[model samples]
Target chain A: MEQTAQSKSRYGMVIDLDRCTGCGVCMVACAVENNVAPAEQKATERTGVTWLRVYPVSNGEGFPANDTVFIPMTCQQCGNHTPCVSVCPQNAVEVDPSTGIVGQIPQRCLGCRYCMTACPYHARYFDWWDPQWPEGTEVLLNPDVAPRMRGVAEKCNFCHGRLHAARTKAAAAGRKEIAAGDYVPACVESCPSRAIVFGDLADETNEVSRLSHSINTFQFLPKLGTAPKIFYHSAKEWVRKMADRAPLA
Target chain B: MRCKGLILMLSGVLASLAIGWFAFPAALYRTEAQPMQFNHAVHTGEQNGMTCDMCHEFTENGSFKGIPTIAKCTECHSAAIGSTESEKVLVEQFVTPHKEIPWKVYSRQPDNAYFPHAAHVKRAEIKCEECHGPHGSSSTLPVYQVNRISGYSRDIWGRNISGLPSHPWEGMKMDRCVRCHAERHRDDSCLDCHK
Candidate 1:
């Protein structure tokens, strides 16, 4: 097995909407693991930064006959013609060829917000305020991640800090390839119902690859031709049809 | 009149060159001495024969320990073997009190930049002298110069004001990393180096 950093691995995710309970544990885990700062006093949903957000999608029906599904939306790690990458004037957004992860470098971002506008999924977030925590909560921030400053756009990179750690551990042991279980993302690990499956989508033997090609697995906004790596699995026809439509305001 | 005009123009050109070359650098960087003098040559010399990795070791997890702690120094210097004032100060002040020495690192990069020494040294087999120059073989430690605006070591941009390196190992800027990666045919992404 080739090293993950050098190998052509399409790292992706598979979310089972049926299994999701909308517990929001994945959001909390993502915030803690990535050192995402708490929202400020004046910050609203529009202005706040959330790398992973869980939305409750419901079928329009009476309370007794209604159906709902929790959709966990992130960067999607688009593989082809990524809108954010093409619009970023600073070149801060890029899809890594080695692993199909769309990375956003906050340090290189000039707060232009072009990438945010270009992203059809509305995943990219602009930092409206400087990162802050409670008086005594600063020490609890993850040492592996450096908090982003104000005036930059940021989004999920599938917990890249963990990836770096996994690679380092492999290199120390003189192994080129990282073990499959060693590089699980925080969101996947924190999902209580195991609704999320994450692995190398290029590997046919991997569970994520198998789930991606499963009968009910569908991608969001498929007609846009972004070719996102995130695959959603739902048994309901309504959920699959809704996946093709754009998010409502 | 033409000769006088020429002389005035020449003086203006010389003044601008002087300011750009000398005065600018002087104002840009501030220098501070290390906590104490260290002789790398003495450690690596025939008597000690200590290699760079022996002191600047990599952790078990493959992270580079930038500088060794006083515990490493206390291994051999539990008692002052030499009668030099520096060694005496090391034993009596630091070693006796179990206090750590505050060594100013010349190649300390910004928080945003990640340079994995393990990958470079252990994986690529790059010598310490490749990026750090021959400081490991030097007898005396040079003054650590920091850029006032960036709060980074002057070594990051190299000693030259023009940003042109006098030696291959001088600058540790992004361009330098890119050049080496390009030369080695390694096409790494931005996230590989940036956090």
Candidate 2:
């Protein structure tokens, strides 16, 4: 068999939405960590950019129970045949072979926001305005990553920077591979509810892969053939219903 | 022989002047700005000699640092009687309205990069001026230039992309960061810089 990049990395996430409380901590942490710019107070859905969005799925209201569920959405990092990957004219995005990360190259992105439309989950966001932090807050800007200039598309990268860091650490330690705990996304770390779990999907022994096998688990929009690395688990049938399209009649 | 010596002396002077013009930038790198000037020299006085940390503090986890808030400034300047005309205008425009001074940042790290100023400054004893240039010496004011697109000053990108600083630091960029970590044999993880 010919060696390829796919053999090296198969990154993915397994989220237990049932454990999620809709606190938006994951979203907030992702925003700050990834350097996602802010939206004006008055900005509407059309203008706001949220790479990791918490979407509300309501079991239509009734007196007995007005129930709702929150799904934290990010790039699916689909396998060989990625929908958004094909349409990118500039090759601004790529599925890294070693890490299985669906990398978004912001510098190369033209800001057409085409990927945003191509994705069913709406994981990508377009920069609508120049980057702004509260005055004097620029000092807090992360030092390791290039803050995206305005007019670029950004999405949840599964915190690839962390993965890169882990690899570097492992290399320094004279290790051949990143230890399991060596890499975790900011969202996973900051989740107050501990709802998100990130790991190498390729490692069947890894917790992410093991948790994915649970009977309660399902990938959001699996029918679309995106083969999203993220897996959501919930005991509730209602929550499962929200993740997938309506079953064929 | 005297005539030749005169030419040589003049040439030496011209050469030194040329060297100063070209090399001075490397010795003292400064960036131009876009907004009205605001400098510590003019603002600092006997009243409130607040340190830089008063405005910029590290987060509890030591993963993040931030600029001072308008509230921090108001602590002293609210009742402060400016000694200069520009100071008077700053009080009126920024302090009175409770608005922040839109001073462009001098040092901005890449978004994925995480620099713990507290760890480096408080723990490592790095001087503030080592990276920020001598704000204490400037008597006039600091002009804040906004990047036309990113709304940041060009200084934040760096003095020049190619002009790496002489010491362990340059305008904070990934190259400088990796090199420092490499020199120390420290673990330079993307996660360390990236969120």
DockQ of every candidate: 0.45, 0.06
CA lDDT of A198 in candidate 1? Answer: 98
State the displacement of the C-alpha of residue B117, model 1, in Å, after optimal TM-score superposition.
Answer: 1.7
Q: Each model: TM-score of chain B? A: 0.94, 0.64
> How do the residues A140-206 of candidate 1 rate in per-residue lDDT, one tens digit apiece?
9876777899999999999988888887777777777778788999999999999999999999999
Q: Which candidate is the best by TM-score?
A: 1
Model 1 chain A lDDT-worst window of ten: A1-10
lDDT tens string, model 2, A108-134?
A: 789888887888777787777787888
Question: Relative to the true interface, what fraction of contacts does candidate 2 keep?
Answer: 0.09
lDDT of 2 at A227: 82
CA shift of A34, model 1, Å: 1.4
- Clashes found in each candidate (C-alpha, N, C closer than 3 A): 0, 21
Candidate 1 Cα deviation (angstroms), residue B25: 0.7
Against the true structure, whose lDDT is highest?
A: 1
Provide the lowest-lDDT 10-residue window in model 1 chain B: B111-120
